[model samples]
Target: MLDKVHDLFRLRTSPVIFFVSAGLIAVFVILTLVMPEGMASFWGAGSGWIYDNLGWFYISGLTIFLIFLIIVGFGRFGRIRLGQDDEKPEHSDMSWFGMLFAAGIGTILMFWAVAEPANHFAEPPRGESTGVEARSMEAASEAMGFTLYHFGLHTWTIFALPGLAFAYFIYKRNLPPRVSSIFQPILGDRIHGPIGKSIDIFAIVGTIFGVAVSIGLGTLQIHAGLAQLFGVSDADWNFIIIIAVVTIVATISAVLGVNKGIRRLSNFNIWTAIALLIFVLATGPTVYMLRGTIEWAGVYLSMLPELAFWNDTLADTGWQNGWTIFYWAWTVAWAPFVGIFIARISRGRTIRQFVAGVLGLPTLFTIIWFGIWGSGVFDIEFNGDGGLVDSVLEDGVETALFAFLAEFPLAPVTSAVAIMLVGVFFITSMDSCSLVLDDMCNGYEGKAPLHQRAFWTVAIGTIAALLLTATGEGGLAALQEVALVFGLPFFILGYFIMYNLSRAMREDAGEVGFLRTRRWLQTLPPEEYERRMEEADASLAEAVVAPDYAEGTQPENAPELEHAEQPPVVEEYRVRTGETPIIDPANPGDTGIPPRG
Candidate 1:
């Protein structure tokens, strides 16, 4: 029994990464506990420094990521599959999009879909400079437009860029699914060195804090919903209990693995969210929302370029810092967690497919989501009582959604659904994040031991609960700022990832040439052609891993190659390409091609 207990907790991870990440997180929690006021002030000062100095850097970096992904997705690299040539996507399209939507911004959309737009409608950014009167038709239009901007393509691009790099390296290049592995093209063998470990450490810590902020936000939102529905006291103990219960559910889901737990919950979240959205649209002013959605989409697209690059430089209103800059930083902080999770489920997809699904689909859903909720709130403010805005301003953003729902029919039912949706979203995000954290810690070898995932889930929940109990909303906001500060490094790292991915893809393109018709090859016997295609895919996979083999190394946690049935394909590939394929005897694989001299 003791041995089994030990086995459950045993980890296949670098001591440096595991201990350092835990140590940093422990110190953060301790500091927050010991000197909550000082830590909050420190985080405030750090946030101010970043906002003053690096606000434009964040905006420009996100814009570059969007442009780079667009170019790569639509350009020649779009044709490159993330995995072997013949590999097909593991999850179906519905499940894939479901997971993406659930993990990307489900909880946030719930929390802010109505609150943000209403706030903006009350006081538009740059209203003084633009001469847009607050709460005017113009302000209403700009409000939804900005909501779409914050939740749209540029935001998704943060996740997409890292997801693309991770997918390419992990699925195609057979590198371990670590942030540092994407840098392998540039770093080579040094990816296993201190620099690589340092990158992973940052990823782990960033992921934790980022997810903790979300957990904190979700808990607060849940508490607000409970208070509204049941008259529950807004006590810290209640918040702790909420975190504890949700963490337990998330831990179980994490242990169940992606297919069984995460995927199902994600599908449920999407469907439930859709039902709730339809409830609003159908029961409320359906025509207005439908028509407004089209108009808002156009408005969003028209304003995207301006909004994407706007840094409040000309006006100097400090508005962008609180809104646009904060959103960008928050998304950057979330990139590692969301990116890796997206990458894990995105194997066997083309770059174009990944980008289109990650950026396009989510953005479309977001536009509709905000369109329904934003337009609903704006309609009430415009035509009905203007109390929705007052509710958001006075009652806090957490209660805004429920308060909005209360103005409609079946307020109780819709509010309950909304709360349920938030809870499920909370669970899905936590489970997915915990899984990603486990992967990073174990170097992405395979499914991590269940205890390790449970540990992360507990740690995240405890941190969130402690932050909530200790410093309440102020501390949560300060911690979120610190998460953004951590994101600055990732923003810098994004450029290097883009460079490395492009260089690696360019090299591969040079070797393999571009996608072309194989009419002559197809004229052969069907079985023969199939065999040839399989051999080609095997050869491509080998080519990707050949460099590591040449250097007598393998990525940490990479699976050993098995040679039981792949020799003929390698020989066939060698004969056709007129290139020698070296085979490593120690790690023999029928499909494994070794380093070419």
Candidate 2:
């Protein structure tokens, strides 16, 4: 027991990633502590410069990634599996979707489902119907379309690129599961040196800050829920307590391992969110939402290209920075961490299956969710006497959902459930992010030490709390700006990932074709084919029953057995013919050993 305890706390950590990520966080905290005013000014100016100058880069990079993912998903490479051809997936489809939703977008969906749509409706994007009033039916439809645009296929593609690359390398190539491993084709063994470590460290930094943004948002929303439900004091100490409680819950979940804690919690979160969505759909304008969902989906499809590339350079509304650019940066920032979780759950699935499941299903959920909330809020504001638009205008976006719920029966009960759902989403995200961070730091040498995971959980919670507390008045925005700054490098990295994955997939396809052709040759009709089949059967029987059987050795009943039933043999003719053995097309050097006989 004592030895086990020692092992738990032992230094089985990745030296460079661990220290480098830790040092980055330490420096930020120290800056915040020692020179709070100067740090704020520097971060504010730097983040502003980045947003103002590089918005186009973020837009173009994400657009390219989305297009690449679509091409690859429908192309020949889509049929390839992440693992060996014969291996099966580790989790059920439902469980897989649940976990991905929880880790990748659950909290964001919870936080933004109502607020985003309402905000867009309240202030329609520039150059809409000239006379349409804010929150009008036309404004609501445009708002839902915009929401779908932000949370739709493009966002998932950013995640799918990293997840698919890692899955191919880790499962197909038998490589370590690191962001650097995706660069193996480009850098070769140099991936194991400083270049690789630097890549992983950068990913770690992005994940930490990205997840910190989520945590900060979760805590703020939870405080709002508590203040609304139980009338709790909206004090700074109380906010700190909320972060502490959620962090403790998350740490416990992380320690419980993936299957037991994370999976179960993710399932709970999805079911609860579904129930809430259903309640709104059933109780509100069901027909408008149902019909509106289809209409908005169409609008989203038609307007996708325009919305995807729009930088508002000519309009100068600064709307792109606050909404579109911010959402893109947030998605890119969180992709590495969420992609790790996606790859972890996606063993034994084909590239097409992975892409469809990761990109299609979640985006469907986003559309439905925004459809229900957006349409429902519009119904109340424009058609009914509810003052939701007034509440949003008076208070803030965070209060949109609560204010909408206030018009319903059992407001407190529904609000409480919403809070619980957010809390569980927070927990699942925290645990998954910590697991990903542990893998980034320690590679695939089994799970990182318990203490190492615990350290990350603590660090995440600490940084989130400090960022929130230091800014005080508008801390969430401050944290988001910092997170977006870290996401900048990932835009550049996304291009390399697409190239490397494509290269690997082509290699896999060639090997698969070779084996297929060899099998076809064995099926050709002729006396020669019969002779070859008999020889293959003999070779396989001999190899299996007596591996060291001499070439000419035969049983005394060989002639009689020739007339008996003969099981067709599927010999690996390529290896015997001295041709290169079949390989995972994505991994040429990984020519797996051929079976004897």
Candidate 3:
């Protein structure tokens, strides 16, 4: 007990950051519990004001990230490796992808997949409400399009830029892999100073809230699943108990280290998610699901540009505020956790491969996932007598998935599977979030102390439970407000990541950097460029030895002399093009020994 206490109190991290983050978290928890209504009102109004005023900024930030990431992936910067020239990926492609999906936004998708699309379907954005009723096919199609927009490439692009920047710097430049390190090119060694500490502190705050959001959602869903499956009560205490159990399990997993605990859980989560998806696709409206998936992909593609730029300012519809803006804020808040964790596991990949995997593969999974659940549920609720939408409208979003599952054959089994998937995703996300927060809290030096990880695991669950209890039914909204408020600075900080990444790429000594215009080319005329190239080539070639002249084959120009009377045969000197002869500046007449002829 004494040793454990000592370990917990050890100052392995920056003191300022550690205390400040802890203090802030404590303050928020206390205030939320003591003044629940006031806390909710403040967070809601504050974040809502930002969303209403700066919706354009959020839209533009996401758009810029997507555009910048695409440019990096396909342009001259594509071929640059994240590590040294010969290094390969730490994890295999399969392992990497599984982990990425598990750690990135797995739990978020679980909560939002069925709920978000259905909510959007009931209240379609940018459409005449009188013309399209809830559960209509038009509402379904429009919902899928917008839902895809919410969880699609824009989010991953935000993740990829920072991942690439940090990976390149950590592996190539040997800098610490922290959020603050992304500014090293602009800030220099001061990255270890006060400014850097402030950046990391911000990241820690964001990560804690970001993780709390997942914990809260997972708790709510798990409680709902229990009620749906076993006829358990959905009391707030039951939810608190669920959060406590998950937090304890997550702490154990985090203690087991990344390879053993986190990686295995991630792999399991992916396969479980896949099984759930397949079961839904096979057992539900298989034909409609397939057809709708095809159509939804096309719709998302066609509507992407307009949707990407839409702020709904003219019509004053609050849909963007509730959905798009909230999602952007959530993703931005979680960017550090996702980005840093990806960088940690992605040592051997090229910039292009990382960008593609981060932006494309997971996105493909997201689209197919929304297709299977969103389209499948829509078919039942609209055409069949399923009442899934009614359940959402009446009960809440947390009950949507379980209610949808209850309609199928073997309803109990499917509901149980959904619960298991959420539980696994919850554990995996917590462990991974702990890893990233640990890395940041410890100055990106090494693995955090075990006790520190445990503290954070507890802190995450505690804060989540406090907020949930404090706000009653408004817990998730309060968490979303927290995400939105913290996300504002990071949205701006993301641009700095892009600029610094490009600058760092330009300075790399590898293939990517080689493609940039040489300084001599930029500063010198064509004649000077040719001259410099010739000089460089000549300097490199000068290491080769000249042909030997044996005693009998001495140069014919050598003076003939008797053996005993011969003046020492003088070595001939010549201007060598291929060899670099060392010249002593102070004693230019002196020559070092050369190779024997």
Over all chains combined, what TM-score does candidate 2 have? 0.83
Candidate 2 lDDT score at position 41: 67
Give TM-scores for every candidate, taking all chains together and pairing residue i with residue i. Answer: 0.86, 0.83, 0.82
- 308-387, model 3: which lDDT tens digit per residue? 89878677877787778877887889888888889888987888898899999988999899988888777877688877
Among these predictions, the greatest TM-score belongs to 1
True lDDT of residue 528, candidate 1: 26
Model 1 over residues 1-597: C-alpha lDDT tens digits?
433433456754455677789989999988887777788788888878988999989888889888999999999879888776667999999999999977789899999988999999998987999999998999999998888998999889889999999888777666666788888767664565688779999989988888899999888888888888899898789999999998999999999999999999999889999999998998999998888899999999999889888888889999999988888787788798899899999988999999999999999899999988888987898888778898899988998998999989999888889988998898899899888887776665443567777888898999999888987766787688789888888889899988999876764543234441111000111122233344443333233212233222222333343221223433444323223344333433454334334
Q: Which regions of candidate 3 deviate over 4 angstroms?
A: 1-8, 129-134, 445-447, 470-479, 510-597
**Could you arrange the candidates by TM-score from highest to lowest?**
1, 2, 3
Clashes of 1: 4
Candidate 1 wrongly placed segments (more than 4 Å): 1-8, 511-597
lDDT of 1: 0.79
What lDDT score goes with residue 8 in model 1? 57
Write down the lDDT of every candidate, Cα atoms only.
0.79, 0.73, 0.74
Q: Mind giving the per-residue lDDT tens digits that candidate 2 earns over 103-141?
A: 888888888877887788889876343465676777877
What lDDT does candidate 1 reach at residue 416? 86
Candidate scoring better on lDDT of 1 and 3: 1
